[model samples]
Target chain A: MGLTKSEIFSTEQNQLAQLLKALAHPARIAILQELMKSNTCICGDLVEELGLAQATISQHLKELKNAGLIQGTIEGVSVCYCINPSTWEMLEKETSGFFSSFKPAINCC
Target chain B: MGLTKSEIFSTEQNQLAQLLKALAHPARIAILQELMKSNTCICGDLVEELGLAQATISQHLKELKNAGLIQGTIEGVSVCYCINPSTWEMLEKETSGFFSSFKPAINCC
Candidate 1:
């Protein structure tokens, strides 16, 4: 909600932050976990699985989609959702790179 | 801030989300980059490097410290800050585990 000043940071940093922001909520984390466990496109089961309202689940799903973490497809009448593999790989690589950037100093404050 | 409903998620999920939330800002990302690049405790150089006000830099640094991603120690008149190695390793493991959990489905949605 506040000014993030995203313009000043590198594209990589901003992108990483955006991805992390999408994952900064417990509900989203739960949703992601459910998708991971299913290992297939999930449709309408999330409400029961997460024990959250449909609207709430939908909201979290929308955030995930916006962050390119998940994708939804219309299957007949219902929409099925699953993890976006390319985006997931990108997130993994970027996150790993970010963490690897910090080498622990042997002696420091 | 609104309620995150953290109670519903597992401890690991909550901890990971909290760490991600701390890193959701570009300023914080930049700060982390600076610390990683320095590879040693840095004191009073962030303001000049980041081109942000001292107060703003301090606030970001405080958030990083609170997240246990960084630690600070009083060095004479200035506070020296460096990456917290143990916490960084924890974050790396947790984040890597999270990403590894999502095994992408080959077919379907």
Candidate 2:
């Protein structure tokens, strides 16, 4: 999933899959939660909040950044990170479309 | 992500993350789309539909089934799979909760 074979699917499908893959980890989710709770750019505080090593948190942050889920700005020796609202909105719309596509007709178990 | 550190987060967060991880692949997404299109249990047709190797499709299907996103029934030489509606509903609710939790106030890039 690092680099998906996006040629195999529609752009919407590929984009949706890529975004979902980015959120597929607990560390990343925790990072996003931290950002949400703060409601502002967070810098160098995730390690203390999440109890993970700095390097581990950085890797998770990198993945989130790569997926365009979070944005960062340099501030002194630290990087301030926060959720990218536009991308988050796009994610919400695509995910809602995917999940709500199927109309549960009956218990077809 | 195969077996996440579930103890690190709340049960809801872990479950949602696990579900997203299972869906982190293009093949799995294609499989789900195929299931949705058919509106019934699908068996060996996926190998043909996705154009991936049979083994690859099998593995993807296994991941989806393991995540409770899809349910299968053994029938003769193959297994037929269909969406697990309850799990899908639960996933939708959890995902919506996570995304809608944030009230985007201003353009915070």
lDDT of each: 0.87, 0.84
Q: In model 1, what are the clashing residue pairs, if there are any?
A: none
What's the residue-level lDDT of A105 in candidate 1?
80
- Per-prediction DockQ comes to 0.79, 0.61
Winning candidate number (DockQ): 1
Kindly report the TM-score of the first chain in candidate 1.
0.93
Off by over 4 Å in 1: none
lDDT of 2 at B34: 84
The alpha-carbon deviation from the true structure for residue A92 of candidate 1, after best TM-score superposition, in angstroms, is: 0.3
All predictions: root-mean-square deviation over Cα? 1.4, 2.4
- Candidate 2 Cα RMSD (Å): 2.4
For candidate 1 chain A, the 10 contiguous residues with the lowest summed lDDT are A1-10
For model 2, residues A35-107, the per-residue Cα lDDT tens digits are 8888766768998988677988898899899999988988788788888888999999988988888776454
Which lDDT value does model 1 have at B25? 87
User: Native-vs-model 1 lDDT?
Assistant: 0.87
